[model samples]
Target: MSSANLDQLHRSTLGVYESLLDQFNPGLQRLVALGKTYIQAFQALSSTSEEYFHALGRMGEQALHTLSSRSLGDVIIQIAESQRRLTNELDGMFRWFHSEVLREMENNVKLDKDFIAGSRRRYEMEVHNHASALDRQQRRGHQDVVEYTHFLRDSQKDALKEEERRYRFLAEKHCNLSLTIAQLMNKMGGALHQRAEEWGDCVNETRASRPRTPSRMEQMGMREEERAQQWTKREEPSLGRVPSRGPSPVLMRSRSGSLGDGLGGGRLMRAIVSCAPSPNPTLLDFSMGDAITVLVPEPRNGWLYGKGQNSPRQGWFPASYVEPLDQAPRPPLPRGTNPFATVKLKPTVTNDRSGPRAPGRII
Candidate 1:
């Protein structure tokens, strides 16, 4: 073929491809928009469901309150109101579901029809253009025609593949919608069950003249006691101490003592350092499990001023780092001994080579 004819053929083919793309692009965009709309609709449905459930809960509370008033007429009215509200909610949900389904179906049908028509029109235009170009270039051999035919086939195949992909996407979206509907139904079923139970309880309460069984608070307290007993049984071996049924003697005694006098001489409170304090100029550095005396019960700006039991160091530390021990039980002291008294050191007798040394060096 002549160079001019070849160039003309190339431009015509390019135009046909550009035209196909332009036609397909809008269809693809519409499909994406449809998918997004479905997602948004589902989200709105979920939010509506939540609001409905919340309203139902409020109605249940009102019913309970009416029942508590011990007026059978009021309870009956409340139950009737609840049933009416439930019926309305169910009707609204059904209407919404039907409308959304119909709308989605209509949109899908329209998109499919538009896509099919556009594809058919583009295919015809492409074939006509290729035929005209081949006729103008009659001098070209059979091989050239074969190659051009192959290109057209490949383009047609690509368009078919894109259509299939869109159909698959739509199918998946339909499946998702079905799943969401099923989930909403399940939630509604559960809510219905709960409402029925509440109604049954209210009816029973009205019919029975017997004293009320244990309230929820009493039941919870009993459960807590059982759990505590189980926990103490499991922990006693590890703790190496028997679990007391009531408050320990130590705790009772500690509660009886004044806060300041509980520690020693009404000046300090003994505690064990449970954690190491961060390095600070004003804070004392102590290891974990070290004993200390709290000089101040309350912290000043998140720091506690305390003195270490083993060391003479007195400084501030984080209040969280210590466990108070002033309330713990201790052995009784001797009759004449003061608990906080300083010990007096006795003089040491040393034997020299010549004679016994004077008792002057007191340790």
Candidate 2:
């Protein structure tokens, strides 16, 4: 009977659970007392339940003795057999109850692990499996991004190489055209000189033959000299066209060198925006904390070309507002080189965010 009653620990747990049940209820203040009454009733039932089991066993024993020397011996044998079977069944019920309920109550964890779903241990295994799957998913996503970045970088490099090839071809074609024009101009000038000399000889023969028209001959000569001078002046600027229009090293490398650097290149060197660039259309717009990918490391007129990591636009911005992410921040662009010197913000003081912060005490 005492075994049927819950132990101290279980009774304490029951009381705690009963208190929890009445915690949020709005109906009554006497709910806690009602729960206590129910617990007390359960505890009191142990004696009554024990008496009932014992009474049933005594009744069966008395019945067997009285019926042993009955009007029929066959009826006595049947009663004894039923009693044995009832005892066995009762014993099995007791063993099952003891193992499943009474022994289970002795442990801190009410339910021992059956290794199936619903056990704490199994739940932990499931959680670990889920966590592993999540980690793999995250790693795979990162790998995909890295691969895509490499692919894009290679593609850009190929495109840049193709552009350089085309530029060289165009420069060579331009040189050929300039050379051909120069040759044609020289040939035309030679032909004009030959014609002028032949015409002068003919005019001299005409002047010697017509002695009365010397003044007319002089006027014709003066007009020819004036015309020749005017034509020479017209051809002078065109004479230096071949060398000037040919390919220059500066123009050739403008496309190739700016965007394409080394293995340690544009992607690694980032332009983190320390300050927001001014609102100018030529300048790329970005806020502080935005990162820019440096496409061109070389500064031109205090400007840099970069594609924004946080944005889609790419253009030149003043070098004053950005600093390297991986490297130590270099001083602002030189005063002579920095065209935005006047507009550039000067930092008078610096504070690391790691510095101790003061709690405001406002009046």
* Root-mean-square deviation per candidate: 22.6, 53.9
Candidate 1 lDDT by residue in tens digits, 1-363: 544654565555555445445654455556556755765686676567657756655666666565454444455555555555555555565455445644564566667656656766776686677777777677564334665566565665666576566557557656765776677668666877787687778778866955556888777666666665564356333222222222222332333364332245213444444445656445577775667666554555555665666676666666555555656634444443433344487899765567655599533
Q: Runs in model 1 with CA error above 4 Å?
A: 1-79, 91-101, 131-140, 145-150, 165-176, 179-183, 204-363
For candidate 2, write residues 98-139 as lDDT tens digits: 444333322312121121113223434543554465468677
Candidate 1: RMSD to truth: 22.6
lDDT, each prediction: 0.57, 0.46
Candidate 2 weakest lDDT stretch, 10 residues: 108-117
- Poorest stretch of ten by lDDT in candidate 1: 238-247
For model 2, state the Cα shift of residue 253 in Å.
99
- Candidate 2 accuracy as TM-score: 0.19
Q: TM-scores of all models?
A: 0.32, 0.19
- Residue 130 shift from truth in candidate 1, angstroms: 3.0
Evaluate candidate 2 by giving its C-alpha RMSD to the native, one decimal.
53.9
